[model samples]
Target: YNKYFSLGISVADEMFGLLFFVLMAHTAYGDVSYSFLEEMKRGSVIGNIAKDLVLDVNRLSSRKARIDTEGNRKRYCDINLNTGELTVAERIDREEICEKKSSCVINQELVLENPLGLHRVIFNIEDINDNSPQFKQSVIKFEIRESALKGSRYLLDEAHDADISMNAVQSYMLQENEHFLLRVLTRTNGRTYGELVLNKELDREQQKEVTLILTAVDGGTPPRSGTVAIHVTVLDANDNAPLILPSCLIPGCVHIGYNITITATDEGSPPLSSTKNIHLTVADVNDNPPVFQEQSYRAHVQENNKPGSSICSVSATDPDWRQNGTVV
Candidate 1:
């Protein structure tokens, strides 16, 4: 009787062990999405890092789990095996990789053990306006002719921004100036360039040099900007004629011992003024009246002197030329 009872107990224990094995729970693989800033430091925790992978490790003591990137392309991130924590392995720069594209996606896979599973992670690297607009040169220089017509256009070297999307360079601004305007152009590579267009004419005589400031701005929340100083020099042109200045002396009339001076001014590159000195040599026209040496001439005459005899000689002179001064 004792042998038969022990056999029945062993059979019951075996049957129950088989039933528990048939009812064992099976774990399923998990999938999830996560977001992180572009430049997260290494060793930082990324919570909810596929927490469903192992479910409850405390309750499922038999479950073992781990996460790793696909192959050797773990350029941006690393994952914790025991804690299911994700961390940055290397700094990620969206602009450097995206190149102004609309989206940046980093495709990776994390593997889990115990209840074997495979999971895919899609990391969307977002952009931030961390870069300021930059110019190739700090100072721009140009030499233009003063007579250049209005509506002339001058192409300039383009500016660059290290960020993409709205953080990239959008437009340009020129300082308030009466002589020029600003224009923007886009290239096939999505690079925006700038130009200086002449709206008003220039005059070298009036203004020799012009200093302007060009600013490039981006379309960020707090827009970033950069500036370049533009220096333009206007060249001289011979557009004016010389001018004669009136002298104090009158023309076409002269007298002895008189002087005359002539002057002229030029509007050349280096303006100049010239003067000429002249001495007048008078020519007589018999305009002077004859006069005696004394204010009143006293002629001594003997009473009843001979009628044909000249009592005293009277003298007179004329200022006309030899032929015209002949007196009768």
Candidate 2:
């Protein structure tokens, strides 16, 4: 009875083993597997890193799974968040691969914007405090009429501080000098001026050009400074007097028909001050009475001489010549 019971148990065990074998073979036909374990391992690595960094694993998985499940019509790749690296999972067409080999992958290293590529991806690098403010031009120029009134604002060329806002411009400063003084001139047009004031009225005769040193300081703590030389020129003004020549002395009236010369000069600016030869004309006055060599000359007395006959010879001398001389 014991032997028969043992034989029945062995047969039952053999039947159960055959049924298990058939079930496994039927399931194998539907499982089209190609290293799913390796893919799962790769997926877990990315998923774990994303979890640690609090990134979206679902989004990354969706992007990767799209190509994994469907053979890369859209050409997808997997990124390992843990390593900050990319792995190409499926390639849509042969053109997607550089070498056309099974392992050739698309590179997605973060790079600057490129104009030539057809498709691109960008990752922005957050800025860190890096650069100091700098001026575009070290020197700038402006022209102002030297005749410009005192306290009149003459703005210098505005400087550009290239540093980011709040770091770019500090208050503008003028160097200590006798001739130049600087001030800030703000306007409604969004333009600010580094106004330069002339300490004294410019005199062209004294100095044609005036130079001043100007500086720009950024508002940054321990401010940065830039300096430029400013040149201002004084223009000429026609404000001078005409010069007069000294009077000439001549002997008075002894010689008849004597000529004397007089001149005038100017002390004014050029083109106005140059001397021109001008003759001085003097009119004779009756103050100088003409004198005769002798008061009268003896002549033959004839009782019957014509009433108008010359009785005596007379002569006189005049001190002046031409229109100035007179005979009476």
Candidate 3:
């Protein structure tokens, strides 16, 4: 009698186990996706997973429904079996997870036991403006020649933002100045950079150095910005010619064949000068008249001498040069 009773109990247990296996095998699978803003606080409700997956809310606890992140060390989310709502288990930082990727997604599964059921749950993480643009260096220095052309371009270091898409550095601004302007450029990889363009020519004589502020801005609401000081030292160029001024000098005596040197200097910071040698020559003028040694000429000649014969000659002197001193 005891052996027969034990056999009946074993058959009943096997039949119940077979029925449970058949019920688990008929479980349905589902796929659903939802979006949520990143940096949500812990315990924040994402959505009612039971309603989205078309599951009976009353049976959530009975079926032992839970969220499975596929062996992820950090459980980002959890399912409230009593309320049928999915809540955040840990704060999700989009930058920490996706790291510059345009799209951020956390793949999870809604798992149920007893009569096992599986549902794929995808969570799309959206970005927020929590980061500001930052430059590697606080001050950037440049040495530009004063002779640079108006359209010359100089590449600048781009600002870095941890946030992706619109929250990243979007544009650059240059302070109002006469010599330089700002131009924004895009890269093939969808990153943006800045270019300092020479909108006006530079003159080291006028301005030896220039200080400008460069600002990088993000496309967030009430956008955040970063600033870098640009210290540009205008290098001197030989663009200016030397200027010579006219002047008169009163000297006691000046020789007819004197050499004079003239120098011209420019208005550069380190002034430049040029020298020229000039040979002076006196010109003939009618300012002096012939005069005798004794103020009167004395000539002794024979009355019967020939017209071209020799006679006692009278000489005169003039303190003039060249043709003006000729005593003919």
lDDT digits (tens) for residues 1-328 of candidate 1: 1222355457796665453432232212445556666766777665546464545534232444444454555556666555556777778887776776777877665544465445666678888888999998998999988878899999987778888878889999999998999988888977789889999988998999999999999999899999999999998776655555444443333556856777777767667666766776644566666666667667877788877997667677766666657665
**Residue-wise C-alpha lDDT for candidate 2, range 65-107, written one tens digit per residue:** 1112222224234555334333444422322222212233332
Report model 2's TM-score to 2 decimal places: 0.39
| Candidate topping lDDT | 3
Over 4 Å off, model 3: 1-27, 240-259, 264-328
- What is the descending TM-score order? 3, 1, 2
- lDDT-best of 1 and 3: 3
Per-model TM values vs. the true structure: 0.62, 0.39, 0.68
TM-score quality measure for candidate 3: 0.68
- The residue-level lDDT of candidate 3 at 177 comes to 92
Which 10 successive residues of model 2 have the least lDDT summed?
110-119
Model 3 Cα lDDT, one tens digit per residue, 133-152: 99999989999999899999
List the lowest-lDDT window of 10 residues for candidate 1. 19-28
Model 3 Cα RMSD, 1 decimal: 11.4
What's the lDDT for all of these models? 0.71, 0.47, 0.83
Ranking by lDDT: 3, 1, 2
Best by TM-score: 3
lDDT of 2: 0.47
